[model samples]
Target: MPWINDAFWQQLAIGIAGGLLGIIGALLAAQLSSRGKPKKELSYDLRIERALPEIGKELAPHVAIRYKDRPVPALYVVTCKVENTGNTVVKGQQIRFDLTPAHPVLETYFAPKPEPEWEIEELPETEETPGPNYRFGHLAPGRKITIKIILAAPEEPKVEVRDFNPTEHVPVLPRTSTARANVQVRARIAVALLLALLVIPQAFYALGSVGDIAAPVVQLGLVAALAPFAPSLIRALVHLLFRPAPRINLDRGIVMYDGEIRGVINFSGEPADVPDSAQTLE
Candidate 1:
């Protein structure tokens, strides 16, 4: 039998630490879909449906935008998706959307064409709130509503939820960059491959007739060898397939075009990660 050097033991220790972190990541992902009754929360996601430059160089060539014969700036469409992520039903009085900058709303409608009963009222700006607020009706558990707003503002407006005794708001966040994701995938493959190299032969030795170790020790060794390898392989697939896409920071503002997010600019004009390729839209 070949024994590993102390250096190998140190490397194994690092792998063990990494395995623990992978377990933690799995647990946090599970919480996103949890419908625990004890919690009171609303989850929201924003997507830019349409964005075009009103004063871009390309539009300067005899192109005019008018609605009903009246000139208008290039309209920006944004969809705000609010979901009742808790087990308890949420009433109309408990939730509202607080929008910023008091942007002029040209058209407000629901996607998929809603029923007559589905209605929301926009409250006028108040002394306390700098912008307008949209009040919604009752929302049942696991129910969601997607409201599309056509804004006259040059960019998408930031939205905030209020007045609900809500504990938290879950927003979609950016995922790993392409370069980072490739590195992670390769690392996972290497770990799983190396673990298989050790596990398969040990498993064969435990089951084969030439095995000299006691049955109980062999069984324990098999369990120890298989535990780390399974999760490492499974996490590789999860990271590859279900990794969240890079999303706009709704608190600042979203700038998207042709179903692709160009950049998310904040009040300070500082932008977050903007992709240099077609993947930037994601």
Candidate 2:
């Protein structure tokens, strides 16, 4: 009865109530932040080139001809066209093209075949994606341009359009949804820690009681105080262990409109005519 005195029970009850209030406060704060207006918005209009032969808008790969004795694996004149559809001008923009071949023979054929008006830069090769990155400094609204790259492979090559500065046209997210997401992540961590705090010591007490190492009255008081939060503790454990994966849907047509193009090799062949051409875009 000494361990179950009035002061002991009173303190335990206050601790449990304070923890519950803390959880409720964190949840309310998260909900309010989500409903608040976003702090910054990124909006810009750009489109990649696609086939419209009638209007002369296309992303076509033309095969170069080989005369009788001329041996060529396969040579394609890969053309990428990008246009500005938004009202604002895009400045200091660079387009990154990624080339990955299913066949190793095609690796030797990828090179920047730039047009006179365009400037090109060759990016250092990486193990995962080895190709050149072409820079287009500025694009005026409604202005379109074509970038031609020479690809010599045994099969049809694939190209990708990326590295445009669309954010240059819209406000950057200094703080807003990003802050909210960070706060939410902290809340989850807090909840997990609180549950572990509540459960682990009580579990030790239970084991102690079974082994005759704990006084009965003290154990009873702790159990009564913690019983109400058992369901919440279980839920916290489940969420911590089994969170869902984030989903992303990328549509090349929508993401790279205004002349960004991505290409992949669809055909296969030997490395016989693979061109040893690797040049930096100037």
Candidate 3:
């Protein structure tokens, strides 16, 4: 039988240390590679143009007034501007507007012009909310387009905008072009080396100590062998419990094809005559 000598224990300690060191080095490389990767950002600029009176039937939807105007009574031309402010170009974008009238005073009092350009599809009469779905073409970086909607109302209507659609699993970002492939290769190598350190040394120790050590010692050796894998096991458990979810920034805007929104529009009008302010005829 082989002697359980001091050199045996020394080699075992060195093997455990080497395995731990390999694990640490692998983790550090993975973190560094992730940090060096470029970040991808999706952002846009959305602006609501002011209401302007139409010049005539020929230019029914066009508004000459570019400045913001107060919500008032009458037919007002409303324009919305959507701009791509990020590095990537946006394609096949669809935006939805939801309009809600203020109660008995304003309900059923709103009317919008019928035009295909406005893309305002009226939902069933039973539906309480009113608005339109507008389709926008591809927008290059730093590019913008204006959408016009003609609305007639006695008071301001509420409007809301919803653009973000959330999904699972965020896409992995790529490292810099020059180092991408090299980094990936190094990452795989590190992982493989770490696994070898964990498995090879444990096997050698178990085989060497066999028959020489008692049953309790063998159990202890098994525990020691598995201890090196605890970190990875814990990480796997954590990842299983809490997987990453995609983030959608509605206010910041998204690059998707379809979106929904709501807002309020007040029509320009004169308030009802108040007894206090009413002047009696002389």
Candidate 4:
């Protein structure tokens, strides 16, 4: 009967409620801060997806695709993709693709359409400027426009961006298809909300509204609930900050991190182990 007293039940409730409320509070705080400052990462990629001459290699110069009764020689089908790979929305960005050396471009098509109020202008080649500039405006976060071009030139188009600053220089990985990120974003928000609801009582008590005796019990209960997640959180921070970065040494033709080589290698005419003294790129 002593264990079943009103005080005992009260403590139990307070402890459980407090732990939950604390977790909620912490998650909410983190979510707010994670919104982060304004950042812009404009990533541009140019790839020749296909190159079919249609004619023999000796007569390849005559390969052509007709556009409205006009014969346009087809050398390659190049895809130019521009993506806003940053968190904050970037506006008024000027992206220019220059096709130099007087190449013949038959068509420029915008795949998947584009975001609203976007414009693409054609800058004709002048006596002063040799290349034709295709200028685009206003692309938002996670939105990308892929321009597919039917061309009659061997050289790739040069890309230039203006009126925006890149947050960082992150090298774009080569992929046959675009990789989608930040999936199911709503799930994270939902978890944060659920955690906040659990710690409401502790929040009120800590705000100086609850009794002296109940305060410590509630606080401890909340701390106990959140304790299990501490290790994983710490581990994540550690891995993010101190993780080793591996690089491929082209000269030695090996993959290594901090002078330590990883995995096996197959060099056609070279030896199994490259001399460490042969070259050191640190």
lDDT against the true structure, each candidate: 0.52, 0.45, 0.43, 0.54
List the RMSD of every prediction in angstroms: 14.9, 20.2, 20.6, 9.7
What's the lDDT for residue 249 in model 3? 33
Native-referenced Cα lDDT, model 3: 0.43
> Over all chains combined, what TM-score does candidate 4 have?
0.50
Poorest stretch of ten by lDDT in candidate 4: 175-184
Residue lDDT tens for model 2, 67-147: 244544555555555555334555566555665563222222212343434343445556654565555555555555555
Model 4: lDDT equals: 0.54
The alpha-carbon deviation from the true structure for residue 74 of candidate 2, after best TM-score superposition, in angstroms, is 0.9
- Per-model TM against the reference: 0.42, 0.29, 0.28, 0.50
lDDT rank, highest first? 4, 1, 2, 3
Runs of candidate 4 with Cα error greater than 4 angstroms are 1-9, 51-54, 58-68, 118-137, 154-282
- Candidate topping TM-score: 4
Model 1: lDDT to the true structure: 0.52
lDDT of 4 by residue, 1-282 (tens): 667788777866765555555555665565564455665565667776446535667776655556567764545666877777667565544444455555677777778676457665545756654443444455567777787777765455443332222443332322222232222233344444436445554455655423333456545554554454455445545655786765555355654446436577665765466677745544
Q: What's the ranking of the predictions by TM-score, best on top? A: 4, 1, 2, 3
Task: Please tell me which model should have the higher TM-score, number 2 or number 4.
Answer: 4
